[model samples]
Target: MSNLYERSLNVIPPVAARATKLGVVKGEGSYLITEDGKKVLDFASGVAVCNIGHNNKAVVEAATKQIQQLIHGGHNVVYYETYVKLAEKLVELTGGDTMVYFSNSGAEANEGAIKLAKYVSKRQGIISFKGSFHGRTLGTTSITASNSAYRKNYEGLLPSVYFAEYANCFRCPYKQKKESCSMECVEQFDDIFKRIIDPYSVAAIIMEPIQGEGGYIVPPKEFMKAIREICDKYGIYLIFDEVQTGFGRTGKMFAHENFDVKPDIMTCAKAIASGFPLSAVIGKKEIMKNWPAGAHGGTFGGNPVSCAASLATIEQLENGAIENGVESGAYLKKRLFELKEKYPIIGDVRGIGLMLAMEFVGENNVPNGRAVKNIINYSVEHGLILLNCGTYKNVLRFIAPTTVSKSEIDEALGIIEEAIVKEC
Candidate 1:
């Protein structure tokens, strides 16, 4: 009998290569039960999608009920209860001054966000940060600069796009020490506008509030404030792609809340529906209103079941999972910092809430992607699942579920410690 991975090899494309080969049959809180009945600690959280944990009772029940009542009430054709309620809840969450447009994925939502900005601002140019991963769509791929491979054969993408630096204090783009650093990231945009294109031509400046795939890099609060100021000065809309940072993954309902800087347009997905395929473009009501009907429409933007699941996910986050994320995230970070003391090759440890990461580097601060790969493989073989981030692929990111317990964190850290010791 061929195993699931072996069978998958014949049918699945190589582009969909996954982190693990284990055939997961079920999920309970922070663990995944494999085909062979091995219980693996899933710290990746399906790449930070299952915020409230997989197959959560509330989410499943809500989704099940909606599935029975109404499976697909296309947003364009008509409205539904779960869909309208979820949008209402989100609007309220964003301070009741914002309106939402639904989409099926993060990339789709990003496309909507930029289009909304362009529609309202009547501009064509966009400014994005280097090392940002917006999406795989041609429009998003244009803004994404995290990996060149993503744009290999699809060059000459959306034109009028400019890239700026993001704050990665550990591997500062400007190569300046933190103590002496003066927020060059913010200043880089000034040079961008001066040397590249006029700010007035830029419709939107899209960015991941916390650079996720670009290495879990958290920009300085000052940098965020500066970006806000520039956008205000130029009348350019600020778009925060919170696809992976929203829905209480960062201890708060949204990552932007941590910085006290709200974007004119925000895109969220991933954890919004626990594990359902759903996303949204949330914009200031004034801006969203300008995006008239027939300007944008999706046949299956807001699935009823997904919206039900999202409402449940939000309820779960508010109930206790988000609080647990704060406590466990701190505990996890403290442990990683301690591990850093033992492993100098573990160059930097940084992140917010449950979205944490440790950067691996060789002597003289050279990126050590090999170490990260080895550690990940070893951990998987030893019953722990992990993932990596960063442009160099040298970052070990810990995306544990907000519902994760301290014991699970300790277990994952133990496996990681042993894997590092054995591999690195």
Candidate 2:
């Protein structure tokens, strides 16, 4: 029989291309058992979805138990224990002032979030950052500006959508340095509201707390506060797309917590259900209550098994995964900074908790996509899996499981160092 990758060539389209041709038969903790029986250390963690590690015992048991009890009860038609209980838990975790609407994926949850904003505010305009990745749906594609490829040939998208520059201080769109920064990122809204669409016409301003696909860019706390103020001033809803930054990935329950800025609405997924398909639109009760029946609905929004898995995932996060992530993240980050000092190719190291990244650069600080590609190929060939991000694909992001140990991180770093020494 042909291998999985060869077999897939005849059946799967190129649109579903993968980072590696290696197929895995099983996963345990931080390693994947490949089809050829090789153990690969998984540092990408399924793009931050397997937070508690692949096939976590608690998540597996919870999902299996729920499957034995119930499989599919249309969320729009009926109530289920796991679904309702998970919502309640989220509400409690988010301070009891928020309500949740379930969806199957991050894109679906984001679509619901914007719909809720528009419905409640009765506005048609939306504002998103230039380097933000909301989702792939046409509705979300309208608001996403991370890459032109995502929007290629799909023009005439949802109208009344505007773009703004995200607070990427490292690259500073305004060309301002950290020492003498003038906060142009915040002030740009003034120009936007005056020169572009009226603030009153905007239903929502959506952004990722940390730009994932664009680059692991973390903005300053003041920037987040200013955005909240802008939304409040214009009576527009503020939405944080936490799909890749939530559920302990940032060592906090949510990335927004670190900034101490509360958004009017938030969307979460990725690691919400361990490895299950699940997402949520979490909004303030006052705003969510205004979104009436028929405003938004999904057939498989809140799968019982997925919700059970989410609850178990949350349980694991609270039971020490997040704390462990904090410790490991600090260690990894420090080591990365050391690597940056040793290798001039490492232009910068940034991110909070385990969501860290290293941007490779050539002379004069030009993005070095080729170097990143070479390093990743070498690392994977040597038994480690990694992923690249940024519009230029020069940013190597570290999405290690929050349950990762110091030894695992050290092992991964050793592999990374060897790749860098050999390729860079």
Candidate 3:
């Protein structure tokens, strides 16, 4: 076969140039079997989507049984037991008698949260942080300032979206040292809230408990607490984007649980459905009460099949995997710290639970995304898959499925070591 496919789709993007990327035949647990029968360790886990790991028995059975019964009758009018049950489970897991509105992806969930915030508070301005990635939808895109590529050519987007500095210990955007900083960025809030816009004009303060696309940036404890206080002071809702950190990815049911600071509105997706397209806004009862019944919904927002998968996924996490995330996350973190001592290219290592990142920096701690790219490519060539993201794209994000075994962890680490030292 001499590659007969023509470049016929310019409407999508000319940048999507590659064809015949690695093909996978099947996935079981932490390994994906390639079309050529090669076993590749799935460290990325479809960008942290497959938290229970690939081919979970219950998830497969639930999807299969739902398919046999009913795939999709449309979620708008018709009622489905699975959908209701999953929502109930969400309410239970999230606690506080919270309500949920379903969507199809992380972006949609965030988008819905934005609408809900404004609807309830009747406010317009939305505040986000630099290096934060909410989603790719127009509304979510406006808040995402991590990369120009996501915003370029798509300007004049959703307006009134403000940007603050995401917590970066090494590169503190607030002009403070990591150890001595007094959560000074919160001061920026006073200026913005008073002069830039009235407190009543603000809708919500959207942030990640752990900044997901922001190099897995983890703010100090008091920082998030102050954010909560700011939201409270202004009567603005705090939206925790738990798309990547929810469902045991952060070694807790929700990342905010660790800080004792709760969000008024929280969005969850990705792992909620064990790879199915299901997401939701879990928020305060009063705040979410403004929805006028059919205010927000999707054709497949709570598709019965995906809901079943969500139920099963939640069950898995609640049962024991949250604990597993803690144990394994500690083990993995310790190992990465060791790697940092050996590989000077690893300028920083940070993250919680199965979510982690290794920043490649120059001697002066300048970001080196090129080196990170080289390591990712080499790791893939050596039978492992990894991802890179950050303000500089100079970080290797290691979000292995929590179901991964100790041996698999060691194997992937070995491949990463070789890629770091030998690939250069």
lDDT of 1: 0.92
User: Which residue pairs of candidate 1 clash?
Assistant: none
Alpha-carbon shift of residue 328 in model 3 (angstroms)? 1.3
Off by over 4 Å in 2: none
Q: What is the Å distance of residue 146 in model 2 from its true position?
A: 1.2
Candidate 2 TM-score over all chains jointly: 0.99
Alpha carbon lDDT of each predicted model: 0.92, 0.94, 0.85
Error of 3 at 83 (Å): 0.8
Tens digits of lDDT, candidate 3, 1-424: 1112332343546665532256677998898887678899988888888998998998999888998998887878787889888877778877756898888899999999999998888789999999899999888999998888889999989989998876677778876897787767777888877778877889999999888777888888888998898888879999999999998888888889889998999999999888888998999888777778777777778888899898888888878877887888889999999999987888888988888888899878888988988888888888898888787889889888877778889999999898889634
- Total clashing residue pairs per candidate? 0, 0, 0
Cα displacement (angstroms), candidate 2, residue 395, comes to 0.4
Ranking by lDDT: 2, 1, 3
lDDT of 1 by residue, 1-424 (tens): 2288888998999999888888888999999999888899999999999988878999999999888899997898888999999999999999999998889999999999988988889999998988999999999999999999999999889988888888888888889988898888778877888888988999989999999999999988888999999999999999999999998878899999999999999999999999899999999999988889899988888899999999999999999999999999999999999999998889999999999999999999899999999999989998899999888999999999999999999989999999888755
The model with the greater lDDT, 2 or 3, is 2
Count clashing pairs, candidate 3: 0
